[model samples]
Target chain A: MQDPFELSPSECEALLRAGVVGRIALATPTGPHIVPVNYSVVEESIVVLTSPYSLLGTHGRDSMLAFEIDQFDYEYHRGWSVVARGRAEVVTDPAEVERIRKTWPPRPWASGIRTLCLRIRWSELSGRRLGTGWQPMEDLPVHRVV
Target chain B: MQDPFELSPSECEALLRAGVVGRIALATPTGPHIVPVNYSVVEESIVVLTSPYSLLGTHGRDSMLAFEIDQFDYEYHRGWSVVARGRAEVVTDPAEVERIRKTWPPRPWASGIRTLCLRIRWSELSGRRLGTGWQPMEDLPVHRVV
Candidate 1:
């Protein structure tokens, strides 16, 4: 197998835009929590809709967060992962909410009252692709609806 | 869609034993980082073999960490996630290493010199499963070889 290679900025953005679900990593009062979230990439920021009383909604507001998305093949020992690190802020503005709703808004699959919208304006965006002869973008399991 | 229900402790443990890969969440000097690692559950503690100088090895020593594994069906918007939170310790004892090696040892898919063994003795073990009429234990993509 060829060595893993770093993904370009545009490629990372494309993967984030195409992904329907990702994991949010943040430091909680008890410990570090990695929670799965259905997210959208709006203007380079990761947008997620969660419950106000949930673990993410309770502690993720205005907190340093890491958003990760990846596609891996266990049988082949290959995959690509993109991570974005930034501070998250709650979207309280009415206009901003309307705009997000109009764009590629986050559609959570679970049944719950998920009105809280958290946006992570990433300061660092990076990704790595392992294995060779295959493009990471083409291997996405779920395609985002544009 | 049905509301998500809490998984029993036995169910959580079964899923962990069956899973082949999971993500590790921990706090770093920069921020929270989530990295995927091939892991095995040995006596209810998560065991991972990583590089001595990797992120997990550098900051995960005696540090509180969270490990998560899940399987999701994007089309049906249903899935299950299990998380374990605890302090991680590096296994340096030769006898302990021998015992672990005989058991289900971690097999990292990526090419690297992963000699460092970090074990997280989880204090909290919990999980949630969404959807109905399905078993999370039967949904794993990669089954662990016993």
Candidate 2:
């Protein structure tokens, strides 16, 4: 197996954009929590819709959060992981909401009210890929939605 | 689409035992971080091997952590997520290590000197599955290894 290599900033952003689902990690009073949600990258920030009472909607507001997206092949023993660290902001402003809506708005798979919208603006971004001579973006399981 | 339903405790334990990889969430001085790892279930505790200087090994030492394992199908819009919340303890006792080694020991796919063994004894466990009338265990991407 080839040694893993670091992904550049542009590569990480492209992967995030191509991906639809990502996991968000945050510190809650009880302990740390990780929740998977379908997201859309708008203006380089990760955006998602969740119920106001959900764990993410309740504790993720205005908190430093980590977002991760990855794809792995167990048989081939190859994969890539990208992690973004940033503060979470609840999108409430009408103007900001309009801007996000114009872009690829997030659509939650699970049925719910999902009125709350959270946007994470990452300050730190990094990624690493294992194995060799392959483009992860090309191997995405789902095609990128326009 | 059917409303998601909560999985019973026994069902959650079965899913965790069958899963080979899981994501661990922990709080660090910088922020909340999530790292994907291959793990094994021994005595209902999540055991993983990570590099000593890695994020999980360093920040997870003796800290409250959250572990999540899931499988999602984009086409069917169905999936299940199981989250385990517990305190992470580094395994150092020789006798305890021997006991764990006798069970399904964690084998990390990533190449590294993963000398640190961390065990998470969950105090809280919960899971939910979207969609209905399908067996997730049967749909597992990889067969469980003994």
Candidate 3:
């Protein structure tokens, strides 16, 4: 893809809605940490539920973080991904909780937890799609101009 | 919480053995690509079974790549990960295959056709454990300082 690094806003939105699994990258005291998490694509941000006693729960609020969603169809050898860099914080308002609850029903993944509402502050969003092979940036097809 | 970077070798070994899933990062002609696969720990190296037509079958042999395994336990806010980086290649010997197969099933994951045998040439192994709270590297206890 020519523009493999850049993704259309509409495409980015579609990718986010396609699934709830993504990799979350956060900065701990020592270094960077990444973990696969199930998240909801809300508005322009990605939301996840976890125990409130967790480190990411409190330190993540308004803190710089990144969420990545990508799918690689090995059979067809094609996939796209989106990376969202923003601040994160816990969602506490009752009305907001109601809104999120309406779409996300009680699931088995979270087991039985009530206080795991966390939202990522949306910032810059971007992504890319892989083309034929690992061609150089200048050699990709014309349609893939990033 | 200390040693956020996964500094302990034992922790690394445990993560590799305890978890049966991991993502393999490879350098394809297109660029860096990642795929989720099931693997078993063998002599400290991560071994995976793939199909002859799969990417691992094509590039896993003698190809330098990265193997990553990590787990996040949200309840205790504890998790550990181990990453092994080196060359990967196919093992064709029946005796070698039997040895590894005895330790682990021929097919490790829930999906995929298991005919390709891959052994990562583990050059360096390292790991870190995440504690409930974030702590600096210096605060972490040193064990078997590699």
TM-score of each candidate? 0.96, 0.96, 0.48
Kindly list the per-residue Cα lDDT of model 3 for residues B16-86, writing each as its tens digit: 56655566656444333455565676785778888788766775567776666654443444555566777
User: Cα deviation of B143 in candidate 2 (Å)?
Assistant: 2.4
Off by over 4 Å in 2: none
Model 1 TM-score, all chains together: 0.96
lDDT of 1 by residue, B27-111 (tens): 9988899888889888979999988899898998899999999888988889999999999999999988988899878877778
Error of 3 at B55 (Å): 2.2
Q: Write the per-residue lDDT of candidate 2 for residues A7-61, one digit (tens) a residue.
A: 9999999999888888999999988999988899998799999988999989999
The interface root-mean-square deviations, each candidate in sequence, come to 1.6, 1.6, 14.1
Encode model 2's per-residue lDDT on B35-118: one tens digit a residue.
Answer: 989899999799999888998888998999999998888888788989999999999999999999997788777788888999
Error of 2 at B132 (Å): 1.7
The weakest ten consecutive residues by lDDT in model 1 chain A span A1-10
TM-score of chain B of each: 0.96, 0.96, 0.76
Query: Ten consecutive residues with minimal summed lDDT in candidate 2 chain A?
Result: A137-146
Worst 10 residues of 2 chain B by lDDT: B137-146
* Residue A13 lDDT (model 2): 92
TM-score (2 decimals) of chain A in model 2: 0.96
Q: How far is A105's C-alpha from truth in model 1 (Å)?
A: 1.2
